[model samples]
Target: MASEHLHAISADWLKSLEVASSTGDSTSFVSHFLSDGWLRDLLCFSWNFRSLSGLDKIHRFLSEVVDGKPRFEHSGLRDFKLDDHTANAPSPFKLPGPQGIEGVQGAFTFTSTKPAALGRGFFRLTQDADGKWKALTLFTDMQDLIGHEESSSDQHGLYEGRKITWEEDVEAKFRAIEADPTVLIVGGGQSGLMSAARLGRLGIRALVVEKNARVGDSWRQRTTFPKYMPKGKLANFLDSYAVDQELCVWLSSSIASTPVYNASSARWTVEVQHGDRKVIIHPKHLVLATGSGSPRIPTWNGMEEFQGALYHSDFHRDAEQSRGKRVVIVGAGNASADICEDFVAHGATEVTMVQRSATCVISSTTAEKIIFKVPFPDGTPIEELDFRYNSMPKAFVLQLQVSGGTEHVKMFDKELHDSLRKVGFRLTWESSPGSGEVGLEGFVFNRQASGTMLDVGCSKLIVEGRVKIKQGQDISHFEKDGITFKDGSKLSADVIVLATGNEPIMKTARGLLGDEITDQLSPPEVLGLDSEGEFNQVYRPSGHPGLWFASGSFEFSRPSSKHLALQILARELGLA
Candidate 1:
């Protein structure tokens, strides 16, 4: 129904009630009410006046219409308003009029049966001594009514009420420092440089501190070059038959740019040693770009007693020195494979590999497949090929007995020997084991030929074992008097080359920022070191706020340092 019509009807009813009460004429009031069909129908529906047989029905309807519902007896009128509009007219019945011209005031609530379409509304009514009760005002504001309507249409809980606490607000505030400009970065390696560059581009003033003599030292040290084999035919075979076709495609389509060593900005600082030199480089941020270096040496028996030269892989640069010498290369990884190939190329008289486990080598074809993703033309998969052609040492057996006991030996498994033989290698099993005495003794190997056996002896031996790490200790103590092990063994060696890993050194930044601040700026855990390991907390304890870290964790892939540096720069400078 139109709101205008409802208002007009309501005003008319009030006027009729006022006129009838003042005149005290039942006939006139009844005539006025009967004159309007809409008005009379609405009043009858509110009063629940129904057509029935006896006078009791009339009395019941009059009592209800006059007295109101029992719950609202104290407040006044009840059931005086129609609950809903209907197409048909209400039934006829008698309704009470004002008595002796006294005012009749009350409250009424109107509710809709279909709450989905409409809502309930409550209003207060007031009657003067001369008139009946009429709606004076609605209980709620208009906005509340509109809100109720809108709420019914919303199915998703997006409009639900929410409450916020104070602690959550504080935590959110601290996290905002990620966008702050006061971070410092150390190390020019991929992680450190990238973070600095990215921060710089973001309009943050980032400084990069590096201790290496040059940037990209890790890549440069790898000394990669085009590899070739003898007879030129093998090289040609690798270049044509074994080459991966997809390598060229990927190289051409990749969006990555070649890394340039010395950029125009001079943002990276290099070559400042710790303790011995004093250099001033203060950056708010510090990053450790240092990576792992050489393998560590372990103490062994007879090392000090050895009369011949010994070397670690880190110091073995000249393969020609092994010419005509009997060489034993240890380990089963790429480093061992490379060393074995180097010894053979330099014409070593005999080379044997000693490994701790079965070595799985990738064939050239399989390597090509990984890089190219193309199947072989003949339909043979790359993984089916024999890997012995690229095999490395699998394991080494030491002949030993208890001190002052008979010399009995424990030999390596025959499977290791057989696997080595497939790749043109010879193995020598010891018949007698050496005593477990602390003194150094010579190691022997029996050579195997095609059904013929010979003995090849070597005065020099190379011991390859697990990597060792020592912090806050003297480097010289690692091999004091050419003999040192945790257990008191008198092993002898002429020289020692530690293959222990390298760490990103931020000496320059440390010197500028002081130890306390640098420690706060650079944390080893952020750079992927173990939190509880010996090398944990490796950063110098002081740095600036403008520094940031960019490294990989053991669980995640490492980001490209060059790309990161450029991004950091762009961000700090507001160019990205």
Candidate 2:
């Protein structure tokens, strides 16, 4: 019946879109969503983020976007039923078989009536118990820019097709050249490098400056963060750097002064210090690829705090050096778990993890399956995966995640979840509307700091009693020998590693932007949905023109860098 009844529901929804466009009858359009429906809009056609959850929000959005508009239903929708017709569909498209879908998994698409194939959308639907289809998520964004670059010479870039030798006056030629780059990128990590790669293909003049001494050293500075990023783990990300086109990364250079953008020339003056030499560059745009974790520094009560050794995660090197020492790690997030695993292997005499609240825990094996294998199976190119996954609204991912996750919990590893509970580690499952009581991989899409832990091998250590748990205790103060908890308990330690957390990127944005500029600028959120229901600020304009933020997983940053690069190129070339 769900299949039989889908056409009518689809027709009703499409008609409602028309009504909203002409008459602004939001109530009629919003009726299609479930009572507690969520609408998360990414760069879709809005050119910004917009999230409308619940009937009120849905109605408000329709009223605003569809106000007296005409023929808003740009094209007829093509239907896809998950179970019956598309049972053999590839990776993500294969609807949650009967087991994965609570009722029915359906999908549809519509193209823009605009010329030059400018607009399009992909929407996923799920049927309610009432046998009606409602859109769970909608992804609407502009098509790719297809303009070719116009160059006077056969080659571009510094020293290109030059007949000068390294022993010759190479420096003189470099200085004599006068081409102002259109973009200046800060923090030459994954996001910055990838973005430069995209901009290069479009023949845009772009420069990336990294404070580190060498390329690929950024991950090394952060405790071998990419040590686990094997080919499978990283997918096809970093393809830009691995390929022939080498996007230049200036090493050992730091931004020296506040960057000021001049609207008169549509350029930004950036003061950079390369070693002791100051280099000034004028770029039209600035991209900040700096990671967005906010650091947490805890203050213990009592005298100046007589601790042996105390520090936050920012200073943590590795656990091998702390071997045979009594180690006490605060906080039980993913870092805490990874650090604990390292400590145990390195022969830490005692490793204790403290938790102040409940956390969402998922095994690394399960996380790999959900995050990697599901969307990025072998033989599938990353371009397809990026399009398929990025094209869907976050809500759609959350929907499929809830269904698939609940099943994994029920059938997979009850022992692991049970063992953590036995050791007093509080945990929760991602619970959604009809997908049982707990959601499986749903935490990956969470908008809050929702204490979640993706366990690698630390859970085994904790369960085996190698890593002890100290639950629900805030430190009251620290004595020369040990620290006292708020509950009056004491734990002696040779060192205290605070894995509490990090400050938002905005917290440090002031140092670079200066007080006047940073003060007037609205803070960009790293996670969680924004007022327009957006989860990312990448490639999109901040409150100020010519300023942008890029932060997220490698999966997101990979494609989003391209999106941002294209927009910046359009702006500089006056193609927008």
Candidate 3:
């Protein structure tokens, strides 16, 4: 049973409307109704009804009391059956809206039980001067379940045997953005495109700044292609109220019409070169929606002496390049799975996945298909190859040593053995028998023999490490030919792609807002941003009041920019 309360309908009200009332004792129900002063009166008045028949009489009596025509007919006294067909009947009540409020409206819907059975109509709610909420309006017909037959609609239906009412607030904070003029969007993704379409209906100018040369570049850059194209039904459903082209059209229009400052553009200032040159573009009211970058590679010794092609997953754009090559990939994440499939397809001779820890943290479905499963304490199963769990890498370097009285050098690490064993990895240490005038020759192997293994012979090794941002002068010499470690060892590489992650890149936008506003909008440290980091979803810089920051952490499930743009546009146009 649902609990009815002051200015709020109790679950009991919903339960009472069910086909069959619950047999549960009414003690809890009685207590819940009594919990609210107004609900007690309503329930007490309704208590006189012995059953559905009595309920009809009460409905008539209440209709008379309110000076409204009875919309429902009572049948069979005390056992009165409510005409479910009355869903099409007109509502007789209309409550006044609060003073100073205009165009006040609301809507709700009810579900249907029987197949092909029509559902209930929408109902409207409005607020009174005393700051109280009420159902002041309702749909004329309940037969129209979709609520598209009329200008207003509400639904009331039984869900899990309990009646529920979904009421829409007449006053959403973002209603006016649909009617604004000259709206500028910073990022050209789903959020920006959605915002543009909404604004376009209102005759507003919509513009987007996309640093990339093309739209949807982020999705295209992924190593694995989507299994199927998105149906886009959800986007269409949301845009039913507005008259604009498909979401992509709005995005493409914004991208094509807006002057793009790409690598070839003269306006391009920042430049980075490895295999290809990437130029950075500066835009007015910039949006840092570039998303996450590549994973970092850990430093290791003897890495230079391996004489293999080293690469990160981000830098490996094509698997064809690695076909028939020996490959050792580190890390056990989704990217690793994607790369594994790509390597096999591209004809990689053998693939070895080294997981640092005993168990993986992933879902059961993913675990079942994979050859290995590592369970975390939280009941989340991760692919052993997807995440290393608890392993650390130690650096090795080439050096001179006496092997059979000849000078030789190789990588050596006692720390690697200890760390691997601590994480449940089986370690095997082997040393060549010492000869006269020569020291012991040795090598250590931390391998999972039970899991899938790849033959190692002239294979290309791919290493992926955790990503972190390097600040200030720390990254100044990062692009140099050789990497100089803190321990004073140097490693040379044919190619080094800084797979470091991206920061908020808030320099230009922060300058526009000035210091005071940035401080106010800045996020606390817990949200993964530093103390100086600004993480507000709706931020209007002080100096440039109209400029807003729409993208930052909000709910991880849904991107925040879409929600933020709607709210900001609404407020700017006095729609809220």
Candidate 4:
């Protein structure tokens, strides 16, 4: 009901939890939870990502012994309180459980067993069968390491404290990194740079290897970033970020050969090609960060091939090349939509989008206002917001999206969706037809990366008939001047843009690390949810000792980079 009443209930529940936790009473601590409830721990208890479902599992996790000590007992978790600091403080929420049960969801703050670390979390309280309030879900995250906190975002004064000039200092740092980097990053895109930035802030010597000459060169060709940032602008921002963050990067460099990991020494001997020469280096940790691999181009049978130009959308920098030419974009994801709009803008003779399947499209503006505004509002510190957003488990977030949140979004964009349908554009929802998917949110968390399109302006173009839609069947084969569909129909085109997306990151890993290490990766596939509801083969352990994967959008990369860095830090200190 009232915000004050909800806050009071949440406070009471947290107080009980604090008392039980303080005394190290696992049973008493678990008594506050529903039998089937879940506890997702992130670097707070034992420096690893864990999801314990059911009271029994959670109890066992809490009671786990390592080196003759309780895993969570001495975790120094204390001083639990409602996290009123965040935008989404203690408030009323509806759990996506049976009957859409109502509950109180709140952000919380706490201190870890170690004085140098702080923790944050989220908890949902709901009435059980006996009408007694119990936790439906709980999340614990290590917020920051106190003494080793991230560097301030403010620029340093010209004459702060260094004896050497800025250039000299940078050169020295680069030399040190080149000589011996503690962590070697394979790519220099958003994920790689962000991870390097975070690791660098933690005083870790991280060297980024990029085949391109600049940090954001790869992203420059990509049209957009999360939060509606433009491609070119974001690319420049990344370049500036690498410099400002003092991240050491090796440009025009490629991993010359498959890296060899030495288990006994826990190091990798990697040969990197730098320009014309090659340098062999050994680093303790290797971060893939290699993106989603090469462009996924589906080949078709052709007698001699189409005379028209055909290329993957990765190289579709601008539609200037498509001016006065008939363009066919094969896909309905964001890339296709954007490319179609580009063609329309550049005055293509004809712009057609071949939609092979249903796409979940949402208004980008609406999403920014509704979904992002809460956790990522303006005037708030990014670190605080990152913790607040990450405190909620991704599984719980998906559940909410599936239950009614997706419908709320749909309701807001019903007019646009109806307009799209009228134009013969196919659409889908969380529970729509053939499969058990969570719609847009599912594509995000499950890493089905290309199934959703955030409508910026393309939907309007489609509705206004500026962009034509070709729905149904795959192209059977290529025609001299066009492509023939399975339905035996053909559309003439001067240019064919395949917005088919990229292969899974695992494929890249397989080629670079070989099947020996690739096959050992937990879950085998990199994208999609693991048993713990976390993305497989990324951030946390990869079922291998010193290998990690970093993937996802800028939103996920920026925040999760801290988690990934923390795990590496723990290992460096021999704590994990």
- Winning model by TM-score: 4
| Strongest candidate by lDDT | 4
lDDT of 2 by residue, 1-576 (tens): 444565455445555654553343446656766776665543333445566667776666544533244222322122222222232121123443234543223333333332112333444556677867666554444444434432223233434477655434334422332246677788777778778777776677667777777665555545433236643234234433623345656679879999998889777888989778998888878888766544767777652565577877667777788888998888887778877777787898999998876667777677566556766767756855675566555554554545554555434557888898898887766433343323543444443443577677788888999999998456788787677888889888887888877775666676678777666665455455444535645567676778887777677877777667657765665644
Q: Which ten contiguous residues of candidate 4 have the minimum total lDDT? A: 430-439
Model 1: CA > 4 A from native:
1-212, 223-277, 302-311, 358-360, 371-576
lDDT of 4 by residue, 1-576 (tens): 888888889888999999988888889999999997879888887767787778888888888885676866868588888877566588787543234667888888888875357888888789899988898888888877767677755444353676666777778889999899999999999899999988988889999999898878887877554346677787899899999888888899999999999999999999999889999999999999988778999888882589998999888876787789998889999889888878887899998899998898989887787677756879977866676566666776676676666776677798999999999999886433643546677777775656788888999989998888998467889887888888888889999998988888888889899989888877888778877677776788889888999987877787789899988987887667
The lDDT of each candidate is 0.31, 0.62, 0.31, 0.82
Candidate 4 clash pair list: 75-113, 76-112, 76-113
Ranking by TM-score: 4, 2, 3, 1
State the lDDT of candidate 3 residue by residue for 511-564, as single tens digits: 333454455554411122121111223322222334444433212212223233
The 10 consecutive residues of candidate 2 with the worst lDDT sum are 75-84
TM-scores of the models, in the order given: 0.32, 0.76, 0.37, 0.91
Q: RMSD in angstroms, all models?
A: 34.2, 6.5, 22.4, 3.0
TM-score, prediction 2: 0.76
